[model samples]
Target: MAPTKKKAEKKGKIQEFCRKYLTVDFVKSLIFSPDKLSFLTYFILFAELALNILIVVKVKYTEIDWIAYMQECEGFLNGTLDYSQLKGDTGPLVYPSFFLYIYSLLYFVTSRGSNVKLAQYIFIAIYLLQLWLVLRLYSKTRKIPPYVIILSVFTSYRVHSIYSLRLFNDPVAILFFYIALNLFMDRKWTVGSIMFSLAVGIKMNILLFAPAILMLYITSLGYINTIIQLSICAAVQLIIGAPFLMTYPVEYIKGSFDLGRIFEHKWTVNYRFLDREMFENRMFHLGLLVLHIILIIIVAKPCYLFFKNYARLRTLQAQFEPQIAAENREIEDLVRKKMRKATKKADEEEITPEQKKFMDSFEKGMKNQFGDKQQMPQTKEEEDPQKIEIHFDQCVQLALLPIFLINFIGVVCSRSLHYQFYIWYFHSLPYLSWFTEYHTSFKILILFSIEFCWNQYPSTNFSSILLHACHLILLFGIIRKIYKEIGLARQVIKKEN
Candidate 1:
């Protein structure tokens, strides 16, 4: 009878365990925990796919740069290596050689770019690739809410049109940019650097992200590795431009990568408030360039401080490593001594039933708590949790914050921004918005107004001014958030006695 009762009890326990774990609700709960945001991200991505297809089917493909792109591709396909001779309807081939290679392929694919609808569909694929990269990038960070993604991808009428309708080369660079960012976040610094360089080869505008990217390399890979990565970037550009370089090096140099290229005041989205003369002034461009540098440097203060603090933390840890090890050893010795004494006492006496049960429970709890934690950390990331306040994930977040902020700085101080250029920073707006200390309404309103500015057929003075105001306010909010969240400069190293 006793045996039957024990067997029945064990069978009931097993049945309960199966019932709890194998249920539909349990599986749903498991899937929904932690990665709920990632699930939401994918759902939104599919919706974006439907939305893009609808846009392509319903909306007209407006010929903006597609004709010019095809013409440039025609010149290149005719075996023209000299960038000076690669003329489009818009202008000469000012973009790097890779642009030719990319557009040349497109040229062939869409019947020498005559199939506008087919090309629009391709752009839809390109736009989604970039967007998926952005969403995946956002997923790696823990704090950013999923709805912020809607603002980045969904809320933009102009961005949707820029991608599915106009088919600009900007989305290609933007795609590579996000790809490199995702790689960087994954700690594949070498491959990430290559992708980053490839992005820059597509468009010089991608250079706006360089300051943040370089600083990230410096912080993560150190100065020497960062210099090597810089060399890698230059090498990628040179290698891509090799044919043009061998032919008319001067023309390729001046025509492909001329930094002093003027922006047409007519397409300007951010500076209609300024006179045409002032907007296109070389000195004004220079001044904006200087201000851009200054602003990047200013916003980059937190990264510098983080690097400094990280160095100090390493130094302090080195000085205290011996002590930390000794303390750990003492702890291990004390635990062993206690364990030995308890075992010897139990062996010496006929232990009572309660005492034995209590000992077994205590032993199990101790092992559960401390057994896995006893091993010393071997990585440089966090040698001792007691000593190192920051963890690996925190370091990643710190690295990303400065990069996003620096790019925003560029957008704020840009000499001229066109409608298509909105894709450059639109995805980042949501990330930046959540970081700021503003109310949700203010952030949404600013974003809506910015969207309104970008969507306007001809950008007005009022829209441009409002765009700047929103940019400044958002910038201030993010800066304040960073200062509050990561006050590494003020972080003091406490020496344990």
Candidate 2:
């Protein structure tokens, strides 16, 4: 009896300790609470920056294309805009005039092209700016949570490599991309378009984002405004290209916009399974073209449908405002009464299965009909003025979907994928996570797979395919889920009417 009592006492103490320190609320308070989480965010950022600095100091020289960048910068400084004679491992200075002009400014600070420290410092500043812009964009939109910011800051090894080792123009391009996204979210459409144009100028790969941006502009602003904004964007690109066009028009055209340039099989990191001869086959290129066409259609169709349905829903809601409001009030009252009863029952004892079922049904109906009440515009005047209303999270999800799909498809059809290409998808991953409903272990597995593929010295064809395939599955799943939710919403609205 004495031994059993002691054993019981020990078990009770363990349970008490767990209740005090290991409860979900306790863990959530430690990590998910905004104030405590902000500290974690800062610590992660500081640690990443410090580690990157240390790596830069230790390596002292990068093995990638920094030398080529410096050569282009030197050529620009020497007033030799023609890059026909200047070639790098990736071929030539294939970037636009604005990139050359921007790189040339480094001449003012560093005399030697081999000054890796100076280059790293410049890139560190760019990285810090990118981080700040990301945080500001998320905070302003109120779309992503604090945990996402932490994930972005910590899981960005590819970005760190770009800044510290590769020293590519990608970071600069991404800086502009983030700034443009921020501006677009803030409704500074014209300036955002110009910034996006500049991003495309720095690296043509940034054009992957153009379709989505165009759709967003057209939907947010009317046709005339969108056209004007696009014209301004085109004007910015032309202005940046003008000097190069005049000096060496043929070379500028070939270098800046030549989409047909084929990389060698030896240089191909992602398509090794095709082997040397098969990598250069015309049939493969044709297949890629077909794949690109299919992907474009797939990505665009849903965007169009979503926009159309969203517009129709808004119009219908506005037309039946009185009826919708009455229904909403009735439902809200019913939900409150049910909630009160549930709370009273909970105070007395555990909720019955029937009560739980009713609560679940009530919540689902409420969500399908009106979304979260907090997300609905409070003022009737404000609600009526807007043609369409979308929750901030939904808005972000829609805006990023096209870009994510395009980048994924680009990777699928790409003949060559390098570690540096990870930039194309890295920024979108955290946002994509918001739409996914994977278990914690599954999410961790996905993260591990991505990191593993990226860390490979020369990415194997299988790993490349796997990484891209994983993203495709996730994106398609989210897209399907979104449309299904929209369908449910429509049904609920129709029923209410």
Candidate 3:
């Protein structure tokens, strides 16, 4: 039996536990667990498929953003639309022509023009591609099994079908962004940079990764290489964007940057911490800016340290210190041997190889928890001497930092947010999964509980505001912790290097 057997006792199945105190800890563990994919299919795929069917039936069966998208698409297709002439009083036309390009293709297929279901299908295809890329990246880096990928894909309520079904810029931009990240991780800089540029072009919010990416580029490739990559990315953008640049450069930039001008409403769904009324006060904006800057700076310091530490560690590893390295290897081998023994005893009745591997890994991890630290690296000599170098590769992942920073700033400065904007919350999930070593189950539960409260309770002004405040606090905590981890990792890398 797995260690989780005790937790599973008296339960019909894992999903049934949803009724049992939200078991946030357990849920998160399952989601992030190594054995998660051992039997992933019966859970993740079915659940997501079922949920998507329900969503499609409920919303897709009827017309959705079809009317609005059609208006946008028709204007683009007729060539009568200058895009320059098209302006919204609320904001600039920030959405890239890529989406419109997609719509144009769909419009051509049936000649029925822009159909909502068709659009939904198109977005779903894009999402599937994103899912594939995300899984591939996860597998390459973490060695997680494919079934685990399925579980991760579906179990994350925030990232599932709902976002794809919506006709928002988030879905497409996220797809491009993840692909960009994956390409960057693979060290295909030109492709990754172009993808990132396209993501930013599609939706400017993707620019949040700018600082981290730049830092990574500077560290890894040096200033000259970073410039070359940037130039390549810029050239790609110019190729696609030149025509529009010629006609409406100001409109494009304005639409991309001036998001605040659109929201006249005082509050939407995310009304916690502050609101539009507060921003109108001017003093509020100043105060918020100061707070955000302080937090970002605090977070950045740790990330820098983490980079240094990682670099140092890598440098040390390259030295092949036989005595120390061999001892460390022996300890790891012993742990694995013990874990296998334990797994054999526990899984005597029946077991899958994948499950057994996971159990073994889990047990080894547990044993290592109590292992002697002194045996690993007690002296400065054991550490890598080189300074950690941050590269564009790291920047691709680091790009997530800007997302958190910008969003934190936005949460503090913006007047209000809508339920729809919860998509932004989903953006943090990958960061949490890939970046941190914190207790997964615990974090998942906290956020899930908040999400439940936000979703389930009937809206009362007081409850709404209270929930918003709590959510903001949670967001703040998550961001702070993430930055801290990044900093710590940087330090570790630096030491190792």
Candidate 4:
């Protein structure tokens, strides 16, 4: 009995330790204190740089796309515009002329296409810049929770490998994607559209975000503005592709946009169950088409609801413009009166300097919490009547939902998802996780699933399927949550009326 009691006590202590140490809250507190978080971020960046350098020095050779990229760069330097002529073991270069031009510049810098190391150093710099862009985008609107940053760093091992080991162009495209997203968030529509077009020029896979981008522009900026943005996007694409089209039209078109171009099933990281013959079968392609259609149908209703609510909000704002203006004026007047009263009291008080300082600090805290009363607009137009009182964050989550669902479907239907394709959806996971606010266990499980599948050399079919299914589930959950929030907002509006 004594021995049993001692064993039970030991087990209890072990459980307690696990409960305390293995919690999200505990980890968040430990790593996210401003000083500790900054140190950890810099440390991770340094370690990643060191690891990339060591791999570049020690591994020295890769049986992947980098060799082909270098060969193509050489062709560019030799004034060869035809990818067919420059085709190597990795097949023809399908990326746009802008991509080749960038490589051509790198080639010239690397002693006329001789030094791979210098080119890799350039890639490392781009990777670091991409990380900074991601951090900036996340930290722009609100403070990024510690776990998001941690996951962004740790769950991206595959991305790092792709940049350093494989030296793929996916990272460059992703960097542009991040820049576009950041600019779009700040409401720079035209420039953001141009950046997005440049990303698509690098890789057509970036088109996965097209639906969301279109929806956002339409709802936020109206049909005319959206049309203008689309025109800009098309113009940019044309300008980027003009050189290749004029020079080697057939080869460029086949290499850049041909989905039916040969892809071996064995080369696929996902869809591993299908063999070469099955992959090439027309029936298999049709089945994939059906799956994509079904995914789109599932997302259609929520997308409709999202836009419908936006329209309703616009109508409400327009109808209630006068009321909203009057209410704003009332609020401004109330704030100003409070501020004046506080100032008058402070001036009348004959207090010690220490007391005055304390009062001033308290007043400053109040101003910070409530915002500066002086900044309130005095004019009707200046008060921004067009601004919807709806939950903007929830709207953003809804807008991103269909985009993620489309990418999820793409992953599921992909005949050949190489390591580079992971860039299409991996970086968006942190943002999705932030918006969903799922249980910590579920979040961790999804992150692990994605990281595990992406890290696989020949990705196991089961893990790949699991990763796609998990992302779809997350997207569904987020859409459902947004739907509920919108419903609740409607109810509140009705009640107020």
Candidate 5:
């Protein structure tokens, strides 16, 4: 009896130690904190690298558009500059100038595009780089819960297939898009604009982010700067496309930027339920376009209101709250750590203690992000002991939220989405999910359901319906968030009045 009691006491002590050291909060902090996110990002990138390399070595490379892309590039290399004349196995060249140059370079690099293994490796590099950039965007804001990173990276077989098994032009353009997004977050507006324009030159699909970008440019840069930015975008496109545009202006515009191109019915992923006739109907396409515009108009008001509220929130937080200043310090600390790590040699790297204090206050950092956290100033200026770093939330709202939101809406509305198109918004899925009011489980369900739908080859009617349903659910969730934010602001204003 004495021995048993002593054993039980020992067990109790062990339990207490576990409770203290391995609590749920500790796990959450380790996984979800912004400062810890860098470690996870690196882990995922390396894992993805291994997976991509393995897939390239083990799985046979599927030739889809590579041959056609190479043929088109070869024609250009053969000095056939006429956009109207160049043809490949699939069809005429539809992508813009950047596409031509990229594949042309690939053609030579991959031994006239015959070295499939080497090309696959190159694309794997692009895929990894793109993932890194995407992770950087998410990290800059650290808005989405870090676990949502799994939803973006690990779950989607299609994304893996798109990047590795089949080398699509989509990944290349998207790589540039993400790079530009990171540049925007860094406030390099001019260079970002150029990269974005170059992305557009690779694929017109990138224009989905244009409306939100235009809004960001105007608001952030003012009229004159906005004009200059827009001009730079145009100039990049014009300069890259000069070869085809100077000689075959009409063909270049009609072929490369064709918005009215009718895709074959069998290839449709998003609209598989529609019969061939309905899918090809000009009226149906026109209706979708109109609906797209109407939804954009509806979302426009909420965006404007959110922006206004954000302005008020910023003003109030900067003046009245000591909280934001503290939050600024926490973020600045992380940024400084990043700078140090970026430059630090492994031997020179300093080992740091766990930041349980900052982790404890993590949720409070988002206080001003939603509309309900505003408080009147004490008529006293905030006295910051340290230089207040720019808020991650501000950078997020400035570049990420609206841009990602608008592009997502476009994805939901797009008439046709091939398998390769999945990457266009795969990284943004969690962004949409978190921004919405969906319960966490439901958010996961919607994300996985969409992934399940995309994984279906020759997408079935059921999958198509499920995909559309998931899209609508997300759209509604976003709309609800917009209204809820505005509604909260109105209530605050009423109280003030």
Candidate 6:
């Protein structure tokens, strides 16, 4: 009995030690570290790749858009004005001429035995490379959360995996936009500018980002550097566009800009928000533009003011000195110790621990006025009212605002949005979410839900419409929050107070 009791006590001690040191909690802490996010990112990307490959295998290669692209390639080879002529009135060459030129060349060169698969394989390669570029950009912008990056790629309602699987120019443009944003963030202005221009080469819609780029550059590098960067961007665009302007100027301009002047009969995934024919009228286009301008103005103005105020607060923090005498005593003691060590070191010809302590103390005191904490403490002045509001109940409101504004105005009113237009919405949604100020987890959850539906839900009659209406209602809620945060509600509060 004595021996058993002793053994039990020993085991308890061992278990206690393990609890303090080598326990499941310790292992969990390590696993949940920031590095885990990176691992998860790679895992998700790989899973997506595998799923897409399976999709390609399950569907016949000839049944997809790649066949249509092959027809376009044949037209280009035959010196036809339009490559999509093979589709007659049924299919259209919605992409720019450059898009057909590059792919057509690839088709002609690679067209042989098993070349159908080869063409699809080339696209798969491009998608993989583009995914890498997007991931790289996400890494560069540590300011953005990993979940936001994932949500943008996956849940973006417009960027269905099936749409991506189809042959489209959007993927190339998406890759270029990401590369440009990454380079711009890294302060590689010339490189980013060139990439941005190349993106425009693939699709002129990339020109929409100019305002955002200008805003980003202005904030980072100031006016002079922004001008220099802008010039470089202009030069690259001109160099690419000049040849087309010189040779086939009229056709290029007309086809690129005016191709969508008249709307054809087709239903979009978003048509359920309003009547099915909302896009057929030019008034819809004008209304959308007006809304876009208003929203941009509202967002941009407040952001500029808040940033300026925050900058001033930082400058003031640098100047303010702490007044605590307890902090100063340590510095004074260290100075005395240093003096004593200096005398001893003179005799011994070596620095002592006392000397090291004195040097470290002096450095610390120099950094913090009046020997207070060397690091800045979080304070009310440094905090913005708007940011605080965003963190709590206001998060969902912030997430919904840009989605409502952008989709209703920018997307619904655009010249044309084929199935590929979903890429623009999918890629841009999360960033727009950032503007709204939702919690990272909530944004990811909401996005994941939306994406899951689009990917898997049966597209039966009325189902797509119901989902779109649901989306519109969600957007409406978001807009209401934005109004409360930035609009007339604030004025009412001011008057009441």
Local distance difference test, each candidate? 0.78, 0.69, 0.56, 0.70, 0.82, 0.55
Question: On residues 155-224, what C-alpha lDDT tens digit does candidate 4 reach at each position?
Answer: 5778777777666888888888888977875567889999999988888778867766777787778899
| lDDT digits (tens) for residues 348-375 of candidate 3 | 7667779879988977786688674424
lDDT of 6 by residue, 162-219 (tens): 3334656677676777777666544477898888877776776666665556655665
1-497: candidate 1 lDDT, tens digit per residue: 24545797799999999998888976665343423456676678789889999999987777879899999889887898887888878888788888888888999999998898888889888887887777676665655655556655677889899889988889998888888988887767778888888888888888888877876677667889889988988899889989888889999989878988888989999999999888878888889889888877666777666554544544455577677678778767776777687667755775667887998898788778899566545766422223323223333445566777788888898889989899888888877787787897888787888888888779898988888988989988887777775654355433321
Across 1-497, the per-residue lDDT of candidate 5 in tens digits comes to 24545797799999999997678986787566654566688888889889888888888778899999999999999998888888899999999999999999999999998999998889889988988887777776666667778655877889989988888999999999998988876668999999999999999999999888877676666679989999999999899999888988999898899999999888888999989999999999998899889888888776655544444554555574577667777878877776666556532542333554565455456564644566445776444346555553444553466677788889888888899999889888887788888788899898899999999998999999999999998989888887887788789999999
lDDT at 484 for candidate 2?
74
- Candidate 3 lands at a TM-score of 0.63
How high a TM-score does candidate 5 get? Answer: 0.80
lDDT per residue (tens digit) for residues 1-497 in model 2 = 24545797799999999988888886776554533443344565577678778878876555677767777677666777675854555557888777876777765566645566787888887877787766554443344556655665566666677788777788888888888987876667888888999998888878877777777777767799989998998899889988777788898888878888777666455666677777788788888889877877766766755554544544454577667567677767776777687667756875667887998898788788876763535664212221333333334445555555666666667766667777766766655655566664565566557767777666677876777767666766666766676688779999999
TM value for model 2: 0.73
Among these predictions, the greatest lDDT belongs to: 5
lDDT, candidate 5, at 103: 91
The pairs that clash in candidate 5 are none
Angstrom error of the Cα, residue 250, model 4: value is: 3.6
Each candidate's clash count: 0, 0, 39, 0, 0, 1
The TM-score measured for candidate 6 stands at 0.61
| Residue ranges of candidate 3 with Cα displaced over 4 Å | 1-32, 35-50, 58-64, 80-84, 87-92, 109-114, 138-161, 272-276, 279-290, 307-415, 430-442, 453-497
- Local error of candidate 3 at 216, Å? 2.2
lDDT: worst 10-residue window of model 4: 384-393
Ranking by lDDT: 5, 1, 4, 2, 3, 6
Per-candidate Cα RMSD to the true structure, in Å, reads 10.5, 14.7, 13.8, 13.9, 13.5, 13.3
Q: Which ranges of candidate 1 are over 4 A from the true structure?
A: 1-35, 306-395, 486-497
| Displacement of the residue 149 alpha carbon in candidate 5, Å | 0.9
Worst 10 residues of 5 by lDDT: 346-355
Model 6 segments beyond 4 Å from truth?
1-35, 62-65, 68-94, 112-114, 140-160, 222-228, 272-278, 303-409, 412-417, 428-445, 452-497
